[model samples]
Target: MRRNTGVFIAFAIVFCWFALLTFLLQFPTVFTEPWPYILLLLQTHLYTGLFITAHDAMHGVAAPGNIKLNTVIGFVCALLFAFNWYPRLLPKHHQHHHFVATEKDPDYHGGNFWAWYLSFLKQYITWPQMLAMALTFNILTYFFPLENVVLYWMLPAVLATFQLFYFGTYQPHKGEHNAENKHRSTTLKRNHVWAFISCYFFGYHYEHHDKPFLPWWKLYQEKDRSFK
Candidate 1:
């Protein structure tokens, strides 16, 4: 219970924030004001939170006490964020870690930004994901305001993918993952606040690859203690 507090807190924040943001978007003139734009960013952050929590679950830290509980939370998070399938992501993520920056690593496609991003997407995105998203969008538009569903629900998830890809994958694993950098990953300069806001401390990513057991929330401390 003590060990599991952070995961539960992170889970609640993302789940509750997503719902709360959706509820707030139901008001009149919401789009006309700057509130919607701010909310979009907040929602996007939560979407990233969803994926981060899921990634933690992949490493067996989300609910360290119970394996079943951990998997369920991860599955729900992935599904809620973008209809992403957790089972599919699990193997691919481990494979990326095993292979690092080589061609065997599904997430690494080298220095070219768009090419790497497209390769990254190809490994995760599926026809089922697209179909499920399309179905959800259509179903949501019938009961909720179309703008609310699109802006708060859909757009944020899309942006969150780019957020995860950029800070978590591309930045850390970019450039040469040579012999000196055995982990084949990079660590950002010390900025705990910026690290959390950017990608949930995943920017301190060399610490992550080095100490895979540490949860996302703990990576910054690892960064400070070991790296610099």
Candidate 2:
């Protein structure tokens, strides 16, 4: 099969799985019992994983070509997570790569652990006015008992949006990942499994920072021999 064809097949499977889970969650019988709630939580995380995959697709990491397709897929995925406005935020993300972690970057920050922690709040929450709008939708989920929409659908949608914003915008180009900070970069390896699973192999971020065009599957191929 063609590369794009394979990617679409993979995406379809994940999408179907998410749909099935959502369907099952809609019936109260599924969540009326403790075991069902546990299952629902697990499915919620899976939905988050699917959204993450959708995110990689938007970034052209999953499949290239067709800008319209990318945009539509991203919007649908974001909408599923209750944050469909993500495409509007892409310019800021794109700028982060061009500027890296330098002063010119909107996301730039010093590597001092405490400084980075404090700066993250400011960087991520830049538009306080928008927070009210964003929170309103999320808060509604708490009051509403739409089992599938709230637990399986909306929760993952929210997590995916936050993960994409953090990993895509902040983690990859952070000053801590700079070439001069080899020691800090070493920590990436320790968490490779989670990165591979949660971010669709985006956790190999150092390699990605070096070669942005490479696909996620090929990221491990570029891993430094020294690390092994």
RMSD of 2: 5.2
Mark the regions of model 1 whose C-alpha exceeds 4 Å error after superposition: none
What are the Cα lDDT values of the candidates?
A: 0.85, 0.57
lDDT of 1 by residue, 1-228 (tens): 778785676668666766776685574435568988887888889889988988888988888878898898889888887889999889988998899888898888965999989988888899989999999889888988888888888888889999999999999888876688988898889998999999999999888988888888788889889855
| CA error at residue 228 for candidate 1, angstroms | 5.1
Steric overlap count per candidate: 0, 1
lDDT tens digits by residue: candidate 2, 1-228: 465762674467467756666465555654447866665555655555555555555567555676666666665654444443555545655666677667766666766544665575455443542574468546655655655556655565456555654564446555445458532333257455676555655666667666666665566666654357
Query: Which residue pairs overlap in candidate 1's backbone?
Result: none
Q: For residue 52, what is the lDDT in candidate 2?
A: 57
Worst 10 residues of 1 by lDDT: 22-31
